[model samples]
Target: MGIMKDFKSFAMRGNVVDLAVAVVIGGAFGKIIASFVNDVLMPPIGLLLGGADFSNLKVVLKAGSEAILNGDAVVTPAVAEVAIKYGSFVNTVVDFTIVAFAIFMVIKAIEKTKKKEAAKPAAPPAPSKEEVLLSEIRDILKEKQ
Candidate 1:
């Protein structure tokens, strides 16, 4: 069918393939940034702020469903059935900041390259042999005058 052929053509486009690859790479890059924020950056920050664990940070809303410990003791693990995680939010903020900064740097570099290209002067056209000969004749005539 013509529709199927058109669809195939669209799917096989280089731009589409490149976009797909970029999306996959972007996902992986996001994971790397998240890990860098959580594992590398947050630890020092948490230590500086009195050993606060951001991931375990939460607000108790319903005091959590009771957990049975030792088959007899009911323990509520700080219920956050409807809680806001400010620490995880901070971690996500850091991740977003890093990714944003990297993208900004890349865009800045690209803009710099574009500016350099724009600033470059075009090469002058080469002089023809006839023009060179004419210039020599003119110089001789001027000297004689």
Candidate 2:
């Protein structure tokens, strides 16, 4: 029960909640970015590259073959194709670059707002009644002297 209570407290903390929300939003944002790259961005680029599909672009490392079966009994297991999918990597890179740029812009905007706040000169505080009275008494003494 103590451990459960501790876990609940930890999970309900502001930073933890914020982090969880961020992760969920980040995942959704990544999906949108992925869709943008796959459906919108890649088509024009692919067309420009002579109808090359970037996702399909790969360097085959090893060839694959169908599994050998003897009367519905497996003789040998099927081998999967191994390849370096550099085009997919390129798409991922583009997505990351866009996300990074967006975050940078947001941070820049926040900084600009902070700078504006800091740049403004604060108004001086009004003198207290006691201080005003003290100053008047001092002026009177000085005049008498």
Candidate 3:
């Protein structure tokens, strides 16, 4: 009961809710960035660097055991296989870069806003007459001693 109530209160806090929302939005933003990189940005870049598809980029390591075609060098069209896909790595790198840049910009904007907010002067507290008298007495004592 006590634990449940505490959990409820914590979950209902504004910061926690804001964080949950941010996580969801950030995930969606990452997907959008990944799609933009794979679908838009990479295509043109790949074309410019000669028509090389990043998705098909890979290293054929070992070429797998047990070759089919009954002692033939040529591999047939239909065959179960495994390949080291380095092209996917390139795509992932691009996606990471885009998402990282987006997150960096968001953090930079948030910091800028925080700095602007911090620059505003807070209201000064009213001083009491007793404090003023104490200061004056201290000054007089300093002058004398």
The TM-score-based order of candidates, best leading, equals 2, 1, 3
List clashing residue pairs in candidate 2: none
Superposed model 3: Cα runs more than 4 Å off: 1-7, 62-79, 123-145
What is candidate 2's lDDT per residue for 20-99, written digit by digit as tens? 99999999988998898899999999999999999888999998888999999999999999999999999989899988
Taking the tens digit of each residue's C-alpha lDDT, what string does model 3 give over 27-127?
Answer: 89888988898899989989998998898898886465544465566475454457889999999998998788878998999999999999999889877
The CA lDDT at 101 in model 1 is 99
Q: In order, what lDDT does every prediction score?
A: 0.88, 0.94, 0.87
TM-score of 3: 0.66
Q: What is the lDDT of residue 63 in candidate 3?
A: 64
Whose TM-score is greatest here? 2
Candidate 1 total steric clashes: 1
Model 3 root mean square deviation, Cα atoms: 8.4
State every prediction's TM-score relative to the real structure: 0.74, 0.80, 0.66
lDDT of 3 at 144: 100
Clashes of each: 1, 0, 0
Report the error of model 1 at residue 27, Å: 0.8
